[model samples]
Target: MTPLLELRGLGVRYKGAVAPALEGVDLDLAAGERLAIIGESGSGKSTLARAVAELLPQTVIQQGTVAWPGLDQKARNGRDIGFVFQDPASSLDPVMPVGDQVAEVAHANLDMDWRAARRLAVELLDRVRLPEPALLAQAYPHQLSGGQKQRVAIAAAIVARPRLLIADEATSALDTIVQAEIMALISALVAEDGMALLFVSHDIALAANLADRVAVFRHGRLVEQAATAELVSQPRTDYSRALLAAHLGLHA
Candidate 1:
């Protein structure tokens, strides 16, 4: 089967930066597969996500192509690739009701009418396990908890049912328990919808638990890519080994 999404020799450099944020990064995400890009701060994981989503800042110079099979190449926006940003509150508009914001995506992408779009939004909120989807739909970004806000953001992303979902530290802000629930929700959604997931996080343990394959980045380069079990049990590079050791120590 053709890959749902592919990134080839991808590179991104911001103006005035001494080095590129990402360099020669290659990734292929098959339908229904979960791939994790894991590394510490400044490892270029988020940069890769932004590049794939075509959400990078204008100051950044990007190279290479992000191709999605069965999707129009011209429609490179949030509608094409769903992005659950790291900060859910900031990703949402403060003035707009959560339902309307979510409905907008459905409206824009699917040409859904207001009434139909709102119903779809509510359904999506329910799909993400948000309690009282109707009530939550009426709430503003400030009215929701961090986890709730994140759920709302995810609901909006999936409203259009995009083929690829790029989550940039989507669970990092939540408490451990909430993180687990959110991760489980993400896993369920991807499996149920057969959507390709690219999860970017600094937490290797979380990545290992959530991703089918883990790709490790160091200084803008992907140093290793392997099955989660293989990468955790038999890391190839010294850097990867050290990262694993650190993760183990943290858990210990």
Candidate 2:
């Protein structure tokens, strides 16, 4: 089957940046497959995610292709792709009621009326395991905890039921316990909906635990890509080994 997403010799450079954020990077994610993009800050993993979602700023000079052979029509941002940002605070509207924020996606992308969209939004809030879906729906971002805000963000993301979910460091801002909960929620939702997952993270351990495959990136380039077990057990590059070592040391 055609891959859900494909990138070939992709390069992205900011208008006046000294170097490209991403260069000559080629990668693929299959439908319903979970793939992690592993890298530290400025390694360009997030750039790759934005490029896939076409969320990059217009000032950036982009080269090469981001194609979806699996999609018959042009892929849309909210309808074909669901993105959960690292910081839910910035991603969500502080003034809008959380429920309507989610309902808006369904209203816009899925073309549902307000009543149905809101009803579906409540169901989604429940699906994401939020407390008191009906009551909490009226709350604003400031009213929710970090974990709860993240859960609301997740509800908004999947409300339209996009085929691909690009979680750009989605769990990074939460505490360890909350991070695990979010990860479990993401994993369960992906499995249930069969949505392709692009889990971008700096944590190799989290990647190993959640991804079927891991693609290691460094200095804006893809260093290596392999099955999760293979990459974890026998990393081909020194950088990969160092990352694994760091994770081991952290847990040790």
lDDT of each: 0.87, 0.93
TM-score of each: 0.94, 0.98
What local lDDT does model 1 show for residue 136?
A: 86
Per-residue alpha-carbon lDDT of candidate 1 for residues 1-252, written as tens digits (9 for 90 to 100):
887788899999999999999999888888778899989899999999888777789989888887777565644465667889889988999999998899988898888899999999999999999889998899899988999999999988887677778899999999999999999998888888878889999888888888999999999999999999998888888888888878765221
- Scanning candidate 2 in windows of ten residues, the lowest lDDT window is 243-252
Give the top-scoring candidate (TM-score). Answer: 2
The parts of candidate 1 lying over 4 Å away from their true place are 69-75, 250-252
Question: For candidate 1, what is the lDDT?
Answer: 0.87
Q: Model 2: per-residue lDDT, tens digit, 29-112?
A: 899999999998999999999999999999999999999999997679888999999999999999999999999999999989
Off by over 4 Å in 2: 250-252
